[model samples]
Target: MSTTTTEVLAFPNIKAIINDNGTAEVVVAGNSRVVPVGETLQDLRDNALALVVAEAKTLQRPVRVRIEDPEGHGELIVHPDGKVESVSYETRPARHRTAAPASTPAAAAVEASDSAAEDVAPADDEAAQQAVAADAPVTRRSLKETSFLVSAPVLEPATQGWRGALTRLGFRMNPSAEELSEREDIRTVSQHWPGPRTIAVVNRKGGANKTPTVVMLSAILARYSGAATVAWDNNESQGTLGWRTEKGAHDRSVLDLIDSSTELLSPSTNAAEIAKFVHHQTADKFDVLRSDENEEGDHEVTAEEVDIAHQVLTRYYRLVIMDSGNTARAANWRRMIDHTNQLVVPVTAIEDRAEAARLTLQTLESRGGHDAELARNAVVIVSESTDAKRSMTGDALKRAKAEAQRIADGFEPFVRSVVRIPYDPALVNGPIRYEALQPATQRAWLAAAAAVAKGF
Candidate 1:
């Protein structure tokens, strides 16, 4: 024979409960519903409580409830198992307020009528409190039809009236990354501002995984330093930073400002105007200077234009990560390298790409023409794949050691540490937002960022 059980739960109002798996269902008052499979009686009760809290939070008010099941107060139960017997709920004080003060006779009459109504409201409030105290096993009876009222306390309009409630919901607040970045912009733009540091995550060979490294490093800097960092799509012909970030094509780009001729030239040339050219890629944190895929004009920016852009950028940013192209080096590349305090050359450990890394090291060593000092500051990174078929030990490592030795032979004392960055796909997609990243992935990115920041 089948069994049927009854339980009563007092909820101030009905709301849909969102389960752990993100599925939602509504539990209504005066209804007898069987708990679904995999959902315990306690689970259902906890869901009801969570739903109540959520509703209270949303309405910004206290909620009222009346029990309709089990025919009695203590007859209601949650965890029927001896492991845990029952659960209880009590209504909190309902918020109330008096009618506003009046000057006119009609208004006065209204206030007087409201004052009389307040006399009866206290009884209702007391009755609600008594209902809250009825958790003990006792007969439950239907009273004169009472309502589960969700009420917002009336407030005086003079002060920052509505703002108080909105503040509780964190209204008009930019996210943490964006808020901190704005402060960085202020500090960077202040008087006595020095030149900003621009580090180009470069590899001349295509498909070298350069873009992902730039994106990850930029995000890491934004999180750790709590500063606004700009990622420039300086890849000449085509770019992917904006596309990958999903910032849309209409986003204002640096190319829109300094294409070929007519550089904004000087620091006095409207800093605000220069700032207007930078698009906040998302809210405010990581800004971007994107690329126009079909920018047809043959107009090419001179070294002077690059210089002006850097000057304006420095005024409003502490760090700029440039994603440069593998094609012919733009005049901006030399100027950028000259201005940057550090140079990051990201390369994979593919046997086929080993010679390309060698040539890049040689190119860095050849800074005698434009600036020798810039070459001295460069850091080489050999990005090892976490899933690389070859081992990090034995002959695979022997080959890696050989590549390191080859670069060391050419650059000698200039080559800094050649750190190995394990391949992380999250770095390729977007910022390591909490919900978007695994705990392990976030830790790996942070560790890599710290390693690089410390000149490893």
Candidate 2:
């Protein structure tokens, strides 16, 4: 067997060397790390290099490094080109366990002491297996979030560059644009809609399963339609969506935009800029615009700012998936709803008809919003079971199917289509690429996306 070895060396200024053959080689300070083909070398030495840089910041001496490959199994020397001098490696405790301790009553007792691991193993293993079941390589980047790139074959003369891109990407335009000022900049499509078609996914009562709906729908729209998607984390009070999506930072907050841009010029939020703030996961095929980590910004984005964002986006993205706050407490929620084409209401399969879906229906009915009439407009997804990540058997699966019909019937006059998304926690927790979804689940989302495109 060929063994692969890597060495970390320190140098003053490390730079990547692009050879004539297009191979990239790096020279570390005064040393080099050569990687033989067909071998994997982790960049652990990068950290050591960082440490050396930190030390050097205070005018400290560069760090030292040493590596060994007894059989020269896979030759990777620090100074393959003799640029780097010499270094030595010191014995240290290994980072991972070399072997398991011999089985003993004491050892067994210690291992068994914690019931948490044992108890959780079955559930976790099942989930892990399902998550890995897809034949695709389980790369971290595959799980990490990503943004979309909208492309158009031909830019329409009447359509603004962005609007043309958006229309081609499968989004519907709202009729409300007619009321906009004739004075408003009107071009082909841009002239038709002057305000940002901001969408707020609000359902104040938690457990509405709001976050997953936002994330998944956004992924679908961006992936299939090929449009830029942004999930505006408007849930100010304890932003849970960010936590669920693994983008727990304020770097891309609305506040960040508010802080950077002057009153005269709200920062031109472009695909690339928005992409930076977003957690891009090409595997998932979408971007997450995380909410404020601490305090919501003092200045809520005004309707005009929202319009400007829409206009700016008209030049870039076709669709904008804003994951608004669920609670009524979020002031921005109302603004978002005002601009939405369709109000998607996802309901879990509950026994009592009135208990789960009545409120959502009643709210829409009260607004007397056309959203209620567009039966095909309002999408209702009845989950087969509560926990989608796990398997449903016997009574559970049967009951789940039964409940879906019950829920659909309960909201009849109001709901146009009742789609079903099985309870797959992996869809919620792991990297959910378009190709990874169950065929049924994918169809439901696409149908929802199609409905959304109608109202775009």
lDDT of 1 by residue, 268-334 (tens): 5653554456555453256676755566735454567667666656666777888877753577555
Over 171-270, each residue of candidate 2 has an lDDT whose tens digit, in order, gives 6432122112111212211212333344445454556566777777777666555556666666543466666664533366555544443431445544
CA-lDDT, candidates in order: 0.52, 0.49
Candidate 2 accuracy as lDDT: 0.49
Candidate 2 weakest ten by summed lDDT: 180-189
TM-score of each: 0.46, 0.49
Error of 1 at 13 (Å): 73
Predicted structure with the largest lDDT when compared to the true one:
1
